[model samples]
Target: MLMAHPAVLRDLVEQYETLSALHAEDGSPESQQRLNDVAYTLCVSTGTRDVDAALIAARHHLPGARVEDDSVLDEEDTPKPPAATSAGAGI
Candidate 1:
């Protein structure tokens, strides 16, 4: 994984900080996307498949940010259908 390289994670962290600052200052969705991408990559580096937990952890570790992981959003109440699998998925 790219994060195995010490510098890769550090570079992403720097980018995340910069983009997050821009998002906070101007409400730029593009900057938010970039920031989220960095967060996602950092989560993936941990080698866990539990994305929700990984995201929460990432938010907790974010520089100068205190994310509320306990709050439930209305959208989360909606039921999501199971993902469709390929024909050979269980073969």
Candidate 2:
């Protein structure tokens, strides 16, 4: 599969994180739209089905990521329930 450059992936992750930190679903439409757009782009770039998986894949592909680090993608790594700031939330 084609992979996005590390720089691009880094930027995408950073952008998504920044937007999420600044806005929620109840925020302005423009911020919400931007968050959704970044999440979609992350999924596409990582060839993953969802933003969470995409984020894992993207982080794994980034520079300095441990190639043998399966832990990052492990189910144990997933956030617990009741959290509201997930990447999939409001997308």
Candidate 3:
């Protein structure tokens, strides 16, 4: 699996958290759309199946991650689903 740059993952995690804090999902259509876009990007970047898992994976890939910290593992320890394709996936 290809891993995203740590800086990029950090930015995505921060962006997603900020949007969530601002209640983007309950805000205007544009805000909700942006949140969804960010969530999807984060998921693809981390090879995770959902937003919650994506956040955890993103943090784990970031700098200073500890081996014993919030470790998540499946039976095979791999991404569960194939990721969706997006032109803006690098975002």
* Residue range 1-91, candidate 3, lDDT tens digits: 8989999999999999999999999999999999999999998998888999999899988889987664677667754677687968778
Off by over 4 Å in 2: 72-91
Query: How accurate locally is residue 34 in candidate 1, as Cα lDDT from 0 to 100?
Result: 66
Report residue 14 deviation for candidate 1 (angstroms).
0.7
In terms of TM-score, the best-performing candidate is 3
Cα TM-score of candidate 3: 0.78
Model 2 alpha-carbon miss at residue 15, Å: 0.4
lDDT of 1 by residue, 9-72 (tens): 4565566667666664366776666666777786686444553554444444445444443422
Clashes of each: 0, 0, 0
- Report the alpha-carbon TM-score of model 1 versus the true structure: 0.42
lDDT of model 2 at position 35: 89
Question: Please, what are the lDDT tens digits per residue for candidate 2 over residues 1-91?
Answer: 9999999999999998888888645698988898899999999998988988889989999989876677455587765568566787677
In terms of lDDT, which candidate is stronger, 2 or 3?
Answer: 3
The TM-score between candidate 2 and the true structure equals 0.74
